[model samples]
Each structure stands twice: as structure tokens, then as C-alpha cells.
Target: MALNSFPPGYTRIPTVSPGPEDYPDDTDALSRSSSPSSSSRRPAWTRSFHLAAAASLFTVCSLAIFSALSATRISLYSQSGHALPLPTHQYFGLETAAVPPCKLWGPGLSEARQNVEAVFYIDFESANDPPLHPDLEDVAVWLEGPARFAADVSYAQKGRYVVRYTALDAGDYRLRVDAFRRTQTGKPYAYWLPLGLDTYNVTVMRQDGSRLRGDGRQELALPKERCRGDEVGSRGRWVRCEDTPLPCTRYGWIWVPRDCIFHIYTPDELAKQDLWIALVGTSVWRGIFFAGVDHLFGPLAANLSAPTSKFWKCWGRLSAESAKMRISYLDFRQQCIADTGALHCSGGDYLANTEKMLGKMAQERGGRGPDLVLWESNDNSHSNYTMLSLYRQWFGPSWTGAFVSAFRTYSPEVPYTHQEAGNIAAYASRNPEAKVETLDISRLGGGLFDTMEFPLKQSATFHWHNKCDYEGMHSCSPVDDMIFQIAVNRAVERQRRLPPRAPTPPATEDVAEDIRFCLQCPPSLDFSMRPEEDVQCFAGLPL
Candidate 1:
């Protein structure tokens, strides 16, 4: 992990074992003090004299040794091996040598409708005296949301400072901590400086806590600091903005570069990552768009035998490296387990199925959690009511969920698409954490059914291949397949651009509001002819 080369025989040792004087350049000290012949001729007792008196010469020697002993250090743990190596003076700067690289800790999980524990650990670099506990007022811990809530460092013991915050509602949240010593004049500590900064994401739950997943006690990598200023005075402010302001993704769930909002993730970017994403819900996620005469029938339609295995094309052009996606289907009234290990049957058992998928996700690459989770609900559910509740439980009341409306239906009574524009507004009003706007495939209004002349005459059915030949074959038209591919591809692109879940503290507020506006909000489509239907058709259209 050390980026720079050391002396040919330089063996890496625990930093505490060496004093500042023990640096490899000690020969310069001997040269400056005495001639080489005289130094070599010096008695063994004289050399022993310097070693014994080293403690009285430089304050840094004692400070470094005791600092290493007293400092409570936190470490990162991840299955993906994404945690960045600790920065060192050789690679970063000598000024940073005294500052401990901030460690990010804890994969915080929310027990739905309960509380989320956001804990931060820091090394008290200068707290040498056990009798006096370090004053932490200068250290700040906060949860970012529409309104920032500062956390209290309520406990400190054994050189470690522990700050704990209880999440009030379910939604996504970013947890941040800033630690630094200050001068007597209230500025940052200049000499022998000690500073640590970190931020991480935390998801809280609103409903059955069991729906939440992951072992909350594991440590996650802290995000890399973006603004590593050498100066001491403004260290606090600079470290807080560790994440450079990137243009927020149009849909909100992902973070994209300022110039790539509409374009989303490029193929190259996806190809370079080692990530895992999970999709859990009902038939909508069970390769609904890939169902056709050429594919299998029912919920497992997309899972084909070797002879007809073309359904994987649903992912479109994305071919990222070491990327895995876990997809699951849950039926209405089915018993499902939540992340909290409780069983729930509401809303098509989404919570349970999602939790189950999380379990499967953990088993990948030797037990790691998914970087992102995407769930598709049945059309019959109210966009605002069901989505917001579910979003609150997964993300927290302050974090937002991405809304994606189903495709429009020709039959008015088919329980058609969500009025995305209206539903987005409604969900946002009640749940500000609902940050990601709905990706409405129905935006292709009239385009799918429009008329156009081509040099080669086209068929009346617009290349229609099958008309629901099998029970779960929702749409078999080649055109419909293209449309579905486009819509879902856009969704994947949005997710692909999301900043790697590691290297940054999980902070979920209206990140969308901070960087960009919704490029295209859901349109106010008219659904006047749709029949009054309270239930979702789970078994598919009559054959």
C-alpha cells in the first residue's frame, strides 16, 4: 500500500516504534556533529549515551511515542477491498505527517420505525494525560439532510472518542466528523498538528425494522478527502467539503460529474468498477421487459437455459468489471423477511424480499453488502403512499428514494402509469427525503404509437413479435422491447454514476438540491379512461 519506494532494505514497521530522529537520514546528524573518522572512533559508551538521552532532546520523540500509544484509532473493513490505503508524509506531504489520516467506521443500519446509530471514532493524537479527558467541542459530528443535525460526542474512554446520534426517521443520511486541535487564539493548531476528517452514508428505517439488513457493527472505508489544505486556520471548513461539488444525477439516487448529468455513466466508467447492486420487488423486476415467446414463462421468464439465454441483453450496453446484480421476485401476500430479521407481508412483501436479497448480496465476493439497492413496486400501489413509506424505512425520512414509473398501457383499465410529475411532487411534499425523481418511461408518449414514414415500408404492428403469447409475457413487440431497454438503461446509467459507496461518508440529504435541478420532471399525463382498479394484476393478463 505504500506508494513510494523506501531504502533498499527499509522494512515497514509500526509507526510508533520510530522516533523523528530515527529517520533514515540520521547519517547527516553524525556528519554535521563530528568527522567520520572521529565518529567511527567514538567509544561504544558515547553512542549508548545518545540513545539514552534521546528522550530529553526532541519533544516530538516523546510526543510521537505517547501519541501513538494514547490515540484511539479506527479502521475500515470492506469485502470489496475498496478502502483506500492510509496517506503518508512521503506520498502526501510532511505537514500531514503529524495529522492522522481520518478513519471512517461503521456500516450503520436503521431499524425501521426505530432508530439508527451513527457512531464516529477518532484518535486523540495529543491526549497524553489520562487524568484529563480531551475537550471535544472543537470536534464536530453532524448528519446532513434538508436541515443539518449536529451529533453529540457523548462518550469517550480509553483514548477513543465515541459520538453517537439517533436517527429520527427513515431515509438516507450522510454522517460526517471533523476533528482538529486549535491554537490558544481559536485558530487551528499549527505545530505538531493533529486533524482527522471523515464522512459516511447511513440508511434508516421507518417501518418494520426487520426489513433493514447488514451487520451494523462492521467498519466501512471513509471517503477520501477532496480539500486537503496545508494551512491550519481553515482546516475545519475545508475538511467538511471533502466531496467536490459534482452535478447531482437527474434522478437523484446517483452522483454524476457536472458535465455528465444527462449522459450518466459512460461505458468505460462502468467497465472499471467492482460493484454489486440488487433489484428486489415483484414481477416488475423479474425480467418483465425481457419476457417474450423466445424466453421462458411466468416470474422466472428471464432466467433461461443455455439454448435460449439472450435475456441478459436487458442490461443494455453496460459491461462493467466485477459488477454483480441480484434480482428477486416477490408475490403479493407472500411472507418476506426484512433486514431486521422480521417477517412482513404488506406491499407485496417487498421488505422481506429485499432483506432476502440483501442476504444473498452479502454472500458475493466473500460476504459484502450491495453498493446500491433498487426495488420496483407493483403498479397498483399508490406512488406517494407506498413508495414514501418504503423509502423512509430504507433511506430514512430525511433521505430520498428514486421514483421510476412503469410503462404506459394502451388499455385505460390496465392500472396505467403513475402520474410521475404529480406523484413526485406529492411524495416530496410529504417526504423531503424522496430526492430522486421518478424515471417515467411513459415520457415516450405517442412516440411509441406515432406514425413515421421510412425508406423501407414498415409493418402495421410496428414489428410486433408476439401478443402476450405466454402468461407472464407482458409485452412482446420489438418496439416495446426497445422502449423498455432505453428506460431501464437510463436507470442503470444513473446508478452507474453514483459515487462508489466507499471513500466517502454516507451523507444523504437533498443532494439533488445542492448541485442540480431535475433535467426532466415526470409529465402530467392524462389517465381519464383507466378503470377504477384498487388491486394490481399479479398473475398477468388473461391468456
Candidate 2:
């Protein structure tokens, strides 16, 4: 019989759409169809039901295939053996066709406890016949959320890259892992360009697995005695100490001066009062600026342009209703020259420019200069020999003059080079009245003296090269974080010594009368206020 033919007891049923309810079985339909009126309806309903079932199965199969091809191929596994779902793939590269493939392995769980360390492993391979991998330094990992910080990245076994970091606060974060390809052109020196990016979601929880409200409480502290100014040991060498525990653990294995404390000021603590901080130095200062801002705020926008002028300046401001803090970075290299552009590393031009910048800041704030000024000499611009000569020549009157001026005005904190630390110490001894305080960051790494001839990697007791670039000139995030911590710690200490201001009175005719008693408030008087409430107040204001 033909394939389309039906049995003799039944009449053929025309095709029709399936209804919401399932049709009766074919055998049941046949029995019911014995009646002439029902025969046509039952068979047609049965056929439609079969067609709908077949279509549904086909649709499911097609969807499964599509998802298998489009879903992310990477896998993430946490230390506790939990697996996290991969996020949808996002493209990041100069050319789509040239983009390489990458695989990631690490803690799969999306949750992490505050102050607990998290580690990730990633590897990249080109799509070419023989896969090529970039160097360890080429990989960059960025963690952004309630707290912004740099992850310590290093090479792992089997060509895998390992990244380690600690979440300082509890919140949702995005961990971005990027692979880059280095390219050098005649115009621009060697630079790395992104080849791909893999982003993962991370939820940092409090130590008890709860949520954290504002910037959480202080995670780490140091002994009060250890918080003094950097000390110099025998032979004028800055006293060295073991690695201190930073909130992020970025400096766990790094060595610093004995007096270096890792007390990071949170945005909540800093938001208490209006402050103006100026960082003056060379290109390295720019990196410090970015690192410092990243720690306090979230990462800066990727499209933000860097300053490129001769006297470049970049400003970052944190504005609150009660407090406003401004961080400004100025290139001091151009300031060391005379008005006629004559180069004099030991001339008064450097001090003149320092005063000029401070004057400008005071004008902006109604005659209040910057509350804190951290100065790092622009030694990166000059050769080691030139710097040594300049340090020697300025040891007498020029050095004393600048220190005296800065001490009297701003109580500036200066971070000196390893070679110059001795000179700074000697100057402090000869001129005890100047009250010179030096933050010795020279022991960290990437100093001008650590050149090719005297490689810090070979001679340093601890591993310092990993935190610095090839030339030992530019430093990575870890070094920058250390410098920022030291600078801010000194700033906080200075702020604590200042006398509390009278509370501001509400705008009223009796405002002056209300604040009269506070006009001569003693410096030793303790206001007993919370950090966030420690704002400057005028004398003629309500208490």
C-alpha cells in the first residue's frame, strides 16, 4: 500500500493546527470514530498532536546546540571545590581575527571574606599553529568594587599566571584579567596592547560572612612607638625591618624601614575634613597618584587623559557635604631650572617653584596653603652621578634653606633616595630646630642608584626586582601602594596634632555670641568627635 494510505476502516484526516489539550490515542480515536460524525475529527486531532510533539523536540535540540557553541569555554573553581558559572564572553582586542584564546583556573566561588586572600590562575595561547605566550609582566589584573586595589601577579608553574590579592571591604567586585601583546614602533617606545579580557564577578563578604556598611573598621594597626619618623642606624643607613602586613597583603614579603607603618586611611576617615595634598616629583609620582587614588576611590575611568605638558599637573578631588579633599600632582622637573631655562639642580628655582605652587593653592582656598606636602626630588630625571654631585653641593646652605622654609610653612614630608638618606639624616642632626622628617622609601625598590651596574636584584637581601620594571626606574603597584601608605600615615599623624576648630554656628544674628566662648579654645582641648565629624570650624560659630 502507498505510504500515505490509511487502513480501510478509517477515512483520511486533513492536516490542522494542534490545540491546547493533547489529542486522544490513535487506537482510541479509531474506536471513537466508528460514528460517522466523529470519525473525521478524532483522526485529524491525533495527527496534529504528533506533529506538535515532534516540533517541540526539534526546537529543544537546536537550542542546546546553539548554547554549546556560544557559551564561555573558561572554567573557574574556588579553593573549596565550588564551581562558578562563566559569564558571557566579551571581546577585547585591537583586531577580532587576531585575538588569542585564553583559559582560566582559580577559585570558582564568587564569594570571599574580607581580609582573606584570593588567588587566580590564567594562561593565554595564540590561535596559530604553534601557540605563543606573552611574558609574565605583560599580564594585568584589575579588581574594582567598594575597594580598588592591585593584585600581585607572578609566574606560576606550567606557563600559568597566578594573581593574589585581598579584599579590604565587603562588596560586589569585578575581577578583570587581561592578556597583552607588546609592540614597539619608531614613534612610541615599547608598549603593551590588550589582546583579550576575561571578567569575573566576586562578592566580598565580611569576616563573619555578613555585609559591610560604609568603609569598614580599621583592618590593621601598628604599635604607637613604631609609628615614629624613619630612623637611621649605624653608618647613617636607614634602619631596615621585616615586611609589614598591609591591609591588602601586597607588601607581605617586601622589606621597608623600621618606622614604616602600614596604616591606610580609609575614605571615611579622610572625609572628615577639608584637605589639600600635593605630590611633587617626576613621572614616578604620576604612578603614585593613580595608585593612591585607586586605593581611596574606585579605579579611574580608562579614558582619562594623562598630563603631558612641561609643567604637567593632575588633580583628583573627593567632595563631601562637610569635607572636600584635593590631591594634586605636579611635575617638579621643570621647576629646578632658572627663569632663563638654565639647569641648576641645586639652585633656588626648585624652592621658588615649591613656594609658587603653595601660593597658588593658598589663593584657591582663601589663604590656607596645602595642609600636607609630600616632596620627592625629581632625581629620576638626572643621572646618578649628577644627583650625587647635586646632593653634595646642596648639603650646606641650599638644603638647609629649603628644609627650613618647608618646615616653617607646611611641615613637608620628604622621601629621600637611598644614597641621599644619609645626607638627610646629617642635615637633621645639624639643624635639629628645623624638625626635618623624612619618609625613607629608598629601601623599597626602583631607585636611581639601582642601575644596570649595581643591579638591585642581585645585591638586595629581599626580592625587589619583581616590584620594579627592567630599568629599575619605574615601580609597580606594590611599591606605589607602600609609598602612598607611608605618606598618608604621616599626614594623618600631623592632622591629629592640630587643635580642633570651633563648631560652625547656623546662619543667625546671634552666631557671633554663640561661638564667643570657643574663640580661645586651647590646643590640648579634646573635642571627642568621630573622624567623619572632625571638620574645621570658625571661631565665631555655635559650639
- TM-score per candidate, chains pooled: 0.28, 0.35
What are the lDDT figures for the candidates, one per model?
0.29, 0.35
lDDT of 1 by residue, 113-230 (tens): 3244555555454445321224422344555432124454533654565666654434556555544332222111111112336556666554465434442212111123221111
TM-score of predicted structure 1: 0.28
Q: After superposing candidate 1, which stretches have Cα over 4 Å from the reference? A: 1-277, 288-374, 382-384, 391-421, 434-437, 445-543
lDDT of 2 by residue, 140-229 (tens): 465555434445556665556677766645667777665545453321112334455567888777778786564332322122233432
Clashing pairs in 2: 77-107, 77-108, 78-107, 78-108, 505-542
After superposition, the stretches of candidate 2 with alpha carbons farther than 4 Å from their true spots are: 1-225, 229-246, 249-260, 299-324, 334-355, 363-366, 380-416, 432-436, 446-476, 496-543
RMSD list, candidates in order: 29.6, 27.9
Candidate 2 lDDT for residue 106: 73
Query: Using TM-score as the measure, which candidate wins?
Result: 2
Q: Output the lDDT of residue 286, model 2.
A: 52
